[model samples]
Target chain A: MTPPPALPPLLDLTGIAVFALSGALLAAKMRQTIVSVVFFALVTGVGGGSVRDLLIDAPVFWVRDPWVAPVILMIAFITWFTPSRWWEGKMLDWADAVGLAVYSVLGTAKALAYGVAPVPAILMGVITGCVGGIIRDVLAGRPSILMRPELYVTAAALSATMCALGTLAGLPLFTVWAIAAVAGFCLRGAALIWNIELPAYSRDP
Target chain B: MTPPPALPPLLDLTGIAVFALSGALLAAKMRQTIVSVVFFALVTGVGGGSVRDLLIDAPVFWVRDPWVAPVILMIAFITWFTPSRWWEGKMLDWADAVGLAVYSVLGTAKALAYGVAPVPAILMGVITGCVGGIIRDVLAGRPSILMRPELYVTAAALSATMCALGTLAGLPLFTVWAIAAVAGFCLRGAALIWNIELPAYSRDP
Candidate 1:
């Protein structure tokens, strides 16, 4: 079998870095030790991709790759020493949006390469983009994003579905990847800017 | 590579059923719908094993096994329709303790069969026994068992560590499995009956 198409390194590293930062930031917020911060960063950075690989019956990606843990550690260190205010702005959200988009698209492409069915492949992509955050939130004892009506998972779903469809239509992998990421990033950015939320279910008492 | 040893079907089924019941009961406590109960049951029943399979690079056991989902569903159905009072006693906890012991032994055995080192194999056992409860607790918005000082995870660790050492010492699988599980179960039972708790960490204010 042909090797799976390699994801763009820039996008992949950026996603990992941002995700590690998010986890470390949460640990910092909780006033945890440096060890906890590093632990959080490692899990958050690799959680989604690890789950994706597991479902596809592949050797876990991080175990084979040497760089992932170190990069996550570096990010955790940076977050640990930095001022909290530096990470508490709209900019961090924008970075996370980009990471979500890129990861979703990459996740879809990898699943398709492994011959997964389209719908499950799309779900894999969403899992790859969103599960790390969910793990982080759960570990921090916060409500998961799925509990909120915000557009986070929806943005991931959009990118994943788009990537799956584009691949099915025989689009070039790089082109489809870029387009899907841009689309997801736009939606997430809009949600951040507009404070958009899905309508909550209500019933007359 | 040699195939992993098969666990006793009765023990396996009991573990799955008890874990599903625990998940469904949590959903019921939260006043969730039947759908949520079923969802919770399936996840909690399979969650630990799924994580173990993933870490071991094994095909996810549930996807291939026909009986797992059906059994979980049956348990969920029983849980949903039963009066809360019917499940309000200590019986469920006892059942869960048995399941935890059996699962920890099985998980360690499987990991060793898959060529994992002993320490990590022991961890896989603990993960297989405990992660489902963690997921169930997180989804129900309750503090996870990990956050408590109970003997729960420690019981799993005991069973897993014993199983690993037994296998290394060339003990018969059946004998080792029984001994390890009984040890764990006895400890857990004592904790439950006596309300044993670990001392909380303290720091000077």
Candidate 2:
């Protein structure tokens, strides 16, 4: 069988770095120890991809990757030394939006390459993009994004679904990937700008 | 290459039912709908073991087992119809302690059977006993047990360590399992009765 399609190495590292930064920043803001910051960064960097791999019966990516842990550690050190306020603006969110889009699309592509069905492959992508943040919030004893009727998870689902559909339509691989990434990034970026939120069930309108 | 030791089917079911009940009961107490209640039961019932299986590269148990889903669904139905007050006493805690101990031991045994090293195998057991509740609490927007300076994780760790040590010492599997479960349950039981908690770092006592 042909090897599964690979995510571009630079984009993959950017995703992990972006995620690690968010986790480390949270810990630093909370005045947690350097160890906690590092631990948080490590989990957030790898949590989503790890869970996706597990669900898809694939080898866990970070366990074998030499660079993943070091990248997370470096992120932690950066957070530990820097003022948390430096990360408290829209810049981090924008970077995270990009990471979410890229990872979700690529994760779906990888799952599809591994023979997963479209629906599950899309869910796999959603898991790959969103689970790390959920884990970080949980560990920090903060409200998880999943608990909010926000566009975050929706953005991930959008990217994953788009990738699955594009593949199903026999679109060119790189073109589909680019479109899916841009679509998700745009939605998430819009959410950050407008503070968009889905109405709670109680609102119904 | 002997097949990995099988947890007694009855005991396995009991552990799952107990965990499922805890999750369902939590959702029910919060006045969540039947759908949420059932979803909680499903996650709590299989969360720990699923993580363990994934980490060990074993096929996920519930994904293939027809019985597990049915049991969790049954638990959801039971919780939905029952008054939440009916489970308000310490009885549930006691039952959860048993489930924790039994599952932790069995999880470690299975991981060891998969040729996981001692330390990671022990951690597998703790993950099996604890992660379901963590996921449930996280999803519900509640402070998870991990944030508490409680004996819950400690009990799981003790049982897991005991199992690993016993196996290393060449003891009979059944005897080791029995001792590990009892040790863990007893510690957890004592914690409940005494309202025991570990000292926080600041307390340092």
Candidate 3:
């Protein structure tokens, strides 16, 4: 199903907006047309959530809600009109980190509400936070998030795990969600500041 | 929802098996471990259908069926054990073309059954035939089907269009499906033999 409708709409929107912006930015960087920018935005904004909804047998979030498409279109328009260099900075990364953190927790919470098992629910969260970017990268034929050794997915997993654990421990929903999001954001931020990376695999056994 | 339950089981399975084999063969070619092979097999086999199901708001086929996972695992094992040279030829291409054709028709039929409009249903058919390989290529960091000028997606689109048109013309379901499948397969087969391709995009206005 969709993210809990009760969550404040602002936080719920952060992920899609940031994801959409990233997709639009990628399209712009490729010198593509407005059509491509909008298409990329729509796909990135909805892809992860759509995948989660399908897995959980819930109606896709965008289909029922009219606002989602319009929001993506607006984001795409802004991206198309703005100079691409305006997006070339650390601020964008920070925004994406915030989105990743909040979305991971939100996805986990929704999965828990739907009676999904804790592990899979946590996975649902990571998938929610990461899949949009992956799809965008694939469509653009760029090196994707998974190919990098960065802390992106790990941060999402951390948030998802924390959300699942906190809920299992009988924590209040708002507190658990806030803490989980912060925890993930902190990890991603630290990675950004320190250039942290996971070790690459080696074939020698 | 899942390709019309009334259809015979063998036809229903042809698409997934061929897709799974392609995924496994790719992994085997890459000299990946059995774990990676199985994962690839599962993802490629179900990826397209899962995407179609999600879009159409239908239950994912493999999630409900116990047989799907085991069959993928079996395919993975067979791929892993076989010598790589065994698959170095045109026969495999023919097999994949069959999968593409049948899956496109099945996907369109399922979407139409779910009350999706004709145009979107046809797109769904193409998506169901192509998304699995696209996802696989992305994960493997390889050149995807979309980058090529070949007639792969076109064949699928032709099948989907024919199926949609046939249904709209009051043709019997079985007749529409069979004819559409054969039409797509023949096109793809001809492409394989004669190297047919669509015109490349040009920058000139």
Candidate 4:
């Protein structure tokens, strides 16, 4: 078999940092203890991919690479020590959007690289992007975003589609990342700005 | 292959109801919506075994036997509509202990019957007994009982050992169940009454 194309370590690092920050912010909001916050960050940063690996009988990623855990912990510690009031504005929202965008593209790329069929690859992307946050919310005893009419999953789906299409068209890796990240960021940003949501069904008496 | 031993439907029904009740009680404490309450109950009651089956490549028990879902749902509905205070106090604790005891023995028995070694079987029993509650606590955003200094895991381990020993000694199934269940119940009850906790280590200066 031909060797698989290499991905930039910078791209992976960016995605991991963003995802870890998102998890830390959520844990901070929940007022979790320092240890719990760090645990949540680590789990949210890696939980989906871990589950995917386990299901596919692959060696778990973090077990092979110890760097992921320390990076997540560092992010968690920074978030925990930082005052909430310092982050209580558009900056927080923007950081979250960036994290979502990065994670979506990364998930799609990883799934494709794993040689999964297109459909399962796309599903895995969505699963990888959203499951970590869903788990975070579940652990916080909040309604999972999946049960809500948020633009989160829609943003992920769009980004994943872009990544898959770009890969199939033999686009450069950086180009694929740029396009997919822009799509996810724009979609999610617009949703937050306009309070956009999926239409709800009303139960009539 | 030798013919599989027959398992009575009544025992299955009883186990399902007991587990469902425990799940429902936890959901009520968490104040989840009706749909979430029912969903939690069903998942908690069947999830551990389903995970074990999936990992072991066994046909999922509920998939093969459809009756389990309905029984769980029925119990959930009953718990939902019942007076909130009805199952409170000592009764709820008793119910929880009973559910844990039954599930632990059932897990051990199932693992042994499937020809798993004694060590894995006992571990499976502890997992099956504790995982549902862990998932429940995680989703409810509470510190899992496993994370706390409690007699929870200890009780399950003891009961599982008894069941494994009983099977090795050629004791009757019901006798094993009785011995394991009573031991588990008493241990858990003691923990509850005494606020027993595991020792926590303090950081050195």
Candidate 5:
């Protein structure tokens, strides 16, 4: 009858906030209205986790939590009122990397706690960490991030796989989660720093 | 425990097949590979119902049914192999209309059976019918059907509302479902025939 170990409140909020901000930033780039920005932020912030919750038959995390929606809306508002120039930097990419890493591990952990198989649980982690951005990009009428030759999903998969393996090996929760998240963050950081990309399918082929 | 009253197999298959075909048709229009066509077909066919199932905490519909995936794949294969000219015409529209109406009523009924409230259940119905197309359009990198001035989601809403109302009034399941679906079909059919559209938001105001 023990409760599952949860991600710290600050950490969870940081992940949600960063993702929400990224969504709003896309809206801003498109020069959409505030309403569209808010809508985008909400969807991108909640999309992945919502998909994961539904698949795992958990009551949707945001629907049950009071703070998540309001926090996303606040992030959207900030994105709206602030000058776009302030958001144009490598800082945004770094923040997004953190969110991806954290959410990936958390998603994998939650899926495992629900008794999902290891491989599917890892898939759940990727879904939780990345589906939101895909949803946002789609709504913005752009190519999905996944459609690009990027390390984004690969980073999430790495974190999820690490977490699943760590849990299976009966490692302590702190060690497992830290290593998983840091490993993902490091890989994503390298991609960003080095302008790395996966090879695209050759059109000639 | 008694089993839930299910939509007839033929009817369900017809809806799934038509939606899957529409999805594959879009892929073909984009000149994507057969694999992309099949992926699009499966996603568009199951997207809405999967969302409803997740929201209601029901085991995902397609995963449980052995027939659904293979049928969708067959539809995709047919679409990929056939000349696009064969799929051109009012027939595709007509089939889509049938799928929309049938899926909407079925979604509402399933939600109600699962103890969802009337308003949310009606929304679920609409989600079940239209979200597949939305997802398809998004993945295809086109404007969402919802963003257009057309009467698509509105038609779905009409059907869903009618179904909810009929159920609330204690009408027989068959009558309610038929009336609801026909109402939606007629509206959508009329839109298709007459090229009806809702007024777009004017920015000049």
Candidate 6:
């Protein structure tokens, strides 16, 4: 069987770095120790994909390739070493948005490649992109994004749909990735800047 | 395939009730809505075994049988409607211990029957017994049992090992389950009553 086409290494590295940074920043906010920060970062970078692969009976991607963990660790180390002030402002949010987009598209593409049906593939993409951060937040003793009224899940779902549509339209993988990434990033960024949230209903007595 | 030997229906119902109660209690502690409590109870009753079945490419037990969810939902509804005082004090703790023991042995026995090797079988048993609660806690925004300073994982590990060993030594399934359940109940009971905890290390420079 022919090997899968090569993905651009730089984009992959960027995805890992951004995800690791997102986890590390959250760990810092929670005042977790450096060890915990590193652990969270690694989990955020790869945990969702691992769960997806395990469920689908695929060999775990990180187990087959070791590069993912090292990149996560390096990002975690850098975040921990940097002064908190450097990340205390707005840059961290931007990184998180970018990470969410990249991971969502990557997850969708991977699921499609694995021959999952479109619905499951879309769900897999959302799970992969969002579950890591949810796990990180949960472990850090914070409410998950799912529990919050935020547009986090919405962004992920929309981005994954874009990826699935692009694949169905037979777009090149790189173009699909770019389009999905932009969609996710813009949605998340808009949510952050505009303070957008899903509407909620109070209990009717 | 010939149907496996029948388990006593009463015992199965008792186990499901105990597990469902524990899940409901945890959901209450997490301040979830009634809907969330019921969902948690259903998943906690069957999630671990479902995961194991999926891993081994076996039909998911609940999907095949459908009785599991109804049993758990009944327990959850009863718990929800009952006065808080009825479930308060020491009774809740006892129920939790019983649930832990029953699930642990049941998981190990199922794994062994599925022809998993000894080590993976034992691991699967522990994971199956413990992972549902872990997932419940995680999703409920509580510290996972793994991070708790308690004897939770240790109890599950010991019980699972005993179950695996008993099966390997050709003990009858009922006998193995009984022995493993006793071990788990005692361990967890001791941990709760005596406040047993794993050793912790200070990250002092």
Question: lDDT values of the candidates?
Answer: 0.83, 0.83, 0.82, 0.73, 0.84, 0.75
Q: Cα miss at A94, model 6 (Å)? A: 1.9
Chain A accuracy of model 6 expressed as TM-score: 0.92
How well is each residue in B1-205 modelled by candidate 2, as lDDT tens digits? 3478877888888889999998898888889999999999988889999888887778899898879899999999998997777888875677678878988998989988877767667767988988888888889988776666568878888899999999999999999999998999999899899988764322111
Clashing pairs in 4: B149-B198
Ranked by lDDT, the better of candidates 3 and 4 is 3
> Candidate 3: global Cα-lDDT?
0.82
Q: Write the per-residue lDDT of candidate 5 for residues A112-174, one digit (tens) a residue.
A: 887776766776788889888888877776777665556887889899999999999999987
Weakest lDDT window of 10 consecutive positions for candidate 1 chain B: B196-205
Q: Which of the numbered candidates is closest to the native, going by highest DockQ?
A: 5
Clash list (residue pairs), candidate 3: none
Between prediction 3 and prediction 5, the one with superior lDDT is 5
- DockQ-best of 4 and 5: 5
After TM-score superposition, the amount by which residue A58's alpha carbon in candidate 5 deviates from its true location, in angstroms, is 2.1
Cα RMSD to native, each candidate? Answer: 6.7, 6.7, 6.9, 8.8, 6.7, 7.6
Chain B TM-score against the true chain B, each candidate: 0.95, 0.95, 0.94, 0.90, 0.94, 0.90
lDDT winner between 1 and 2, please give it. 2
Candidate 5 achieves a global lDDT of 0.84
lDDT by residue for model 1 over B12-100, one digit each (tens)?
Answer: 88888888888888788789999999999998898999888888788888797889888999999999998988888886687678878
User: Candidate 6 on A66-163: residue-level lDDT in tens?
Assistant: 68778888888888898888887888778878878888888878777766656566756776787788778777767776556667777887889899
Model 5's chain A TM-score stands at: 0.94
lDDT tens digits by residue: candidate 4, B94-129: 776777877788777777777666655675676677
Q: What clash count does candidate 2 reach?
A: 0
- Docking category for candidate 2? incorrect
Q: Which scores greater on TM-score, model 3 or model 4?
A: 3
Candidate 2 accuracy as lDDT: 0.83
**Residues A54-137, candidate 3, lDDT per residue (tens digit)?**
888777776545466678879988887777667767756776788788888988988888889999999999998889888888
Q: Estimate the lDDT of model 6.
A: 0.75
Q: Which stretches of candidate 4 lie over 4 Å from their true place?
A: A1-4, A55-57, A201-205, B1-133, B138-205
How good is the docking of model 1, by CAPRI class?
Answer: incorrect
